[model samples]
Target: MKRKDQMIGSAFLCALLCLLMAVSGCQSMEDQNYTVPAAEKSETVNLKFFGNKNEALNVVAIEEILKAYMEEYPDVNITYESVKGADYFDVLMKRIRSGNGDDIFMINHDTMLELMKTGELADLSGLPTIEDFSPGARSQMTFDGVVPFVPTSISAFGLYCNLGLLAENNLEVPETYAEFLAACEVFSEKDITPIVANNDISLKTLAISRGMFEVYKGGGAEKALEQMNADPSLLAEAMRPGFEMVHLFIDRGYVDAGRTLKTEKTKDDLADFATGSYPFMLTGAWASPRVAALNPGLNYKVYPYPAQEDGSVLVTNVDTRVAVNARSAHVEEAKKFLEYLTQKDVMWEFVDSQSSFSPLEDNRLSSDPAVQPLNAYMTNGRSILGTDSNLKYPIWDLSKESVRGLLKGQSVEEVLGDFEAGLKKSQPGGAQ
Candidate 1:
């Protein structure tokens, strides 16, 4: 009886040891490759993205991109709404204050700077996509030492060359101010409009080009910015060269200011260009697709506005921003979507479809052969952001009006004087 009892106890001990070893093996496997069971996965997450891309083309392009994202991450539902126009920033701020802001949104320089100071945007420094941005682009998006936004596209201002027109005239694309002037003379003699005089095309582009020449290329960017920050009158000295360039165009009959002052830019300019009546148009890259759509077979290309004789300065700006709301509940998932958008393949397609440049150096958006001249300046660190100089929003308006004033027979000095005065008033800190 005693021997039988000892054997039973030994068998029980053996069973207990086997159970312990089995549990240990399971834990070791878990440590090596842990995954939650299917039942433990989270429910579908919905994210909202609000932006100012309300135009037809913009909406369609963005929707298509989002569709691909949804297909990949079926568990996520995204809603995109556009809130553009004068009250966009006001509406965005109200939503944030109400604790109902979008998971992600678009931001511009002025708005982004204000939101950054208020701590309304998320810090995106840890994102993998941050490593892919061009230094110029990354610096523009960063605020107060924290990156709160990333640009999706670069806004480049250049001349739209009607290659067919240039070829017909036997004029090569202008490489310098002298060449540009000579081209104008040849076009004028042929009774052709050398450049569109519309507000959207001529003035704004020329202003940016001239601004870059004076501020960035001339090495006055730092000093001029400091003076503007100190007092607005200093802008007049910096802007003189650019404003004078516009005056020269008017004086030489290269641009008809009186007609341009009264003309509707979008309608008149598009119709004129579509007829192949003009040889050149000055606009941003945003206008490229529209131009192509209007005249499908027109042979044209965009080149950086010849700011210098050597094509040394290109005027570029951070055109679009993808920012995450600091208070978002779906931060991780929103970040994932942002990451997806910046992937090389997706970025290239987006840039190509939108007719814009990518903001990443690693994935440099190749330019059309006609517009490739601008790329050299961009790659050589000779580009300037529109917002980086004295071209603040208010100053932009003043600059536009200055051109109109010059076209309407106002003297260049008078118009520039008015601009300086208006800029001073716009400064919140009071002119020193």
Candidate 2:
């Protein structure tokens, strides 16, 4: 009886041991196949972008780029908003001041200057893409050796010539200021309008082209700019040569100041030039597409402004520069997006969609045929920044007003004096 009971107990113990081993194996198998719950995975980061370009093409292009970025980085989400017309700056300032600005925003050179004063821009020196930009573009976006913004596109201001009209008159495109004047003289003698002038941008670009070559070129620009910034009155002397050119245009009947003052830019002037009667139109390369669409058969080409004695100079402005907000909650993510955006292929895609030149060093020449003539000037370093942000006063506005005075029959000295007086009044605690 005792032997039989021992056998039974041993058998029971073996069975219990076997059951424990089987349970352990099952737990091991479950552990091997376990996965983290979807809810506990990495959190998604959200970003917002604001821009001033609300055109259909701009909206579509940016949206497509953002979509591609999101697909590449599945953990990120971006929202884009844009304001149109002149009210964009005001709205942007209000949002920033209210501490509710977007993570990334588009700014012009003037807005960049204003933002720098308030420490609103993030330091983008760490970005590798900064080195990929053209030297001129990088320099324009740099302040005290620190880059705060990334330029996306560069807009060139040039003389839009009616190629058919020039061919009809047996004249070639002008290459120098002297040749430009000579062409204008011939057109005037033939009772044809030399240029279609307007109150906006026409004189401003002309003065910039002439003044940049005559006064701002070489190494003398720094001291002169400093002195002019200190006392705005000095700008008259610095700008006198260009102003004289404006005066001469009026005096020679090359442009009718009275009619020009009444003409609307990009509307009246653009229409008149499309008629193929005027030989020249002083405008930005941005207008080239519109000219083509307006008069598809009109043979035209945009050439660099004929400002130099030996050759022409291209007046360029870095447009639609993207800046990261210093106060953004997702700063790292924002910067990463900028890095993606400025990649050669992505940057070219955006710039080409806008019909502007890429700011990249390796891709300065535009694919657009109408603006191709200005590419040589850009390649040879004959380009100058039309909108210089370092100036203390609003140079564009001042130029417009000064040119307006000239068109209204005010002498160059009188216009300069008026400009000085206006500056003094705008100073702190000066006049209302």
Candidate 3:
């Protein structure tokens, strides 16, 4: 009986020891720090970027920037897709509808406004990079006190002069409207085309350059725009001076209306100007490099449009704006990319590649000899924002159509009447 009892006690002791050991193991696990798996801790973030500038050089530059960013941040993977042609906006809209919009995207001023209305663009107001931009540039990108996009470059429209042709005619580059007209007369007498006009944007830019400062500047623009937005007819009255300037150009035979109306912008105009026959081309400064590439020996310079008698005004469009998608899953990562792009060296390289002016406050003056002359106007605050978002009406489209009417041999009054009619049609319950 004693032997059996001792054996039972030994079995009970063994069982108790095993229970204690199991409890000790449980406690050890409970007391220890939990570690996430390596894969879970280092999940990769993927970002997609969309843009419209699909030129070979632009693609290469963008890829280089993305590669450098990825090198600095290993876990981030960015895929860039650039769509060519006017179909880009359509493609972007389709993507957004399908819930596959890019994390970051390029937008123009008008598109930014449209996207902002739909809450598609992230509010980038308090970003550190915002302070880097000049006030004028910031204002252009701002709507209702919210900055929805960052402008990468400023697109300046100017008069591209054939210095060789100007010298041959004993005329210095025109600095005033009067001087420009006089130069045109000289070229007319010599049977040389004074200006290369195109069907697209030449007349619109001309009117903006001539009358933007007078009508839109000096702190009354907001009120004037409000009035015009309320009463569409007031828009024509405000734009009269600019349209009159267009009429004068046609009436003086400075530009052949039929030829100007038929010529496609940046195509035929660029080709004709490259032949060294036209003294001036009314186009954007971005065309300077193309002009050089077309004719390596062409002596040329880009100057502000001779819009004033005392001085010239530079008409600039803030362009190549980038915005973060508000619905992006990787919002922080997308913002980091924008901050990277805003760095001085990176921004400079990108802006220079586009042959555009930087929007940063400390932007360096363009080194291109052709674009250097307009630096003074930029520094002196004589530059006007050509692509304004303050106005409620579609000023740019209206201006283009009005100029088209002018090109079709309509008088200034007739064109203004058409402009008023179109504005009335756009009003609610006015017309179809």
Candidate 4:
């Protein structure tokens, strides 16, 4: 009996030991090697942005964007330095050449090629957001398969009217060439200059509207633009109507050629328009805020320049572009800012505040009353990008100069001939 009892005790002890061993093994397994993820360390970064929005209102608009960006990225500090007028380009080029370029800067389609020659702008072609850009804007920003900048907003050019003056004059916004002439006559009868522009101005704005109207008259805006690109000289014939339209304005006494030739741009034109000295002015939507800032009580609106056939033609193109410097120490940070700017909410807000349009697949324009008149025109496909045709090439300079010569009393044939000559000279191996 004692032996049996001892044997039972020994069996009980073995079971307890097995249970303890199992528990200890489980504990050891729990304590085995494992890795804990390290927290991401976001380093503080500083970036410098150079832009040409010098007007007070535009400066404020830009500041709003920067403020929002900073809020989202507390560790990133960005400073914007505004460069203004014609001198801005030269100054920026000098800074870039000297290795002192800003981390990010603004560029334009017209100057993109020239700027690229310096080999300073970075290639952003690999960015995923690039696919979101408008076809025309993307083409303009790209060169030889390299994209140097991300277009921020699609810049549009049109006529700005003082609504109060139009109402007082009992004139409806002109839709036809004849209606436009009649309205101008009415304004002239009241002893008001119907149109005013800077000394550097010619019917270039009108020509752009007319040129686009002629090109798009047959329905395929894109196809027609491609043909013009294949052979840029085609623009000479297409753009002739624009010159004639300008001549009509001058001949009808609707505009005083001499005074227009004397008025200074930006300063004089904005002052004239703000003071209600003129009924209409040829300008861009980007300048609308500046006009308002000068005289907040003045009511104004922008519309496409009247076309002979539809009277709803608009000259719309990408204007301000932002790019990063290839040599920037903060390239990744600059790219992050660009990506942040591409967010739909962020992009549309900037476009609306600037009185501009979006270049994204989900395109949108400013909702401001001053810019609403253009909404219908844009939706109806009555607008053309300024980059369409030879305008994207060096031929643009000759085109502007030809318009100036026409304003100076040069014959249409002479001006057109000059353009042809200049176009050939600008081409490789065609110089004479």
TM-score of each: 0.76, 0.80, 0.84, 0.80
Write model 1 residue lDDT over 68-107, tens digit each, in one string. 9999999999989997443566798789888999999987
lDDT tens digits, residues 1-432, model 3?
Answer: 999999999999999998998987755666879898887797889999999876555677788999999999999999999875446777887887788899999986556655776799888886888888988787777787888888888888889899998898788999998999999999888777688988867878888777677665565677777777788877778678889998998888888889998887656888889999999999878767777888999999999999777778898888888999999999889989999988878888777766679899986777678888888877686777776766655566678899989988899999889888877775556687
- Which digits, one per residue and each the tens of the lDDT, describe model 4 over residues 1-432? 999999999999999998998987654657777665555655679999998877766677678888999998999999999866655777888888888999999876545766676677888887778888877667666676788888778777777888888999788888777777788889888877798766543367677677657666656666765666556678677878877877777776677777777666677788888997678888777778778889999988888877676566777767678889989999988988998887777778677777888888787768767878888776686777655422445544565687777668888888888877776665445666
Global CA lDDT computed for model 4 = 0.76
| TM-score of candidate 1 to 2 decimals | 0.76
Using TM-score, give the best candidate's number. 3
Please state the error at residue 146 of candidate 4 in Å.
2.8
Please state the error at residue 91 of candidate 2 in Å: 3.7
lDDT of candidate 3 at residue 246, scale 0 to 100: 86
Instruction: Write the residue-wise lDDT of candidate 2 on 1-432 in tens digits.
Output: 999999999999999998998987755565676677999888999999999766565678899999999999999999999986446778998999999989999987667766887899999999988899887677677775678889889888889999999999899999998999999999999888698887877877788788766555664666777777778777666677778889998989889788898877556777888988899988778767667778999999999888667888888888788999999999999999999999999888778766689888787467779988887776676777777655555566677899999998989888878767766665445587
Every candidate's lDDT: 0.74, 0.82, 0.82, 0.76
Off by over 4 Å in 1: 1-44, 54-61, 82-101, 117-119, 189-191, 218-228, 251-253, 258-268, 309-312, 327-333, 389-398, 404-409, 425-428
Task: Look at candidate 3 and tell me the lDDT of residue 304.
Answer: 91
375: Cα error in model 4, Å:
0.6
Candidate 4: the clashing residue pairs are: none
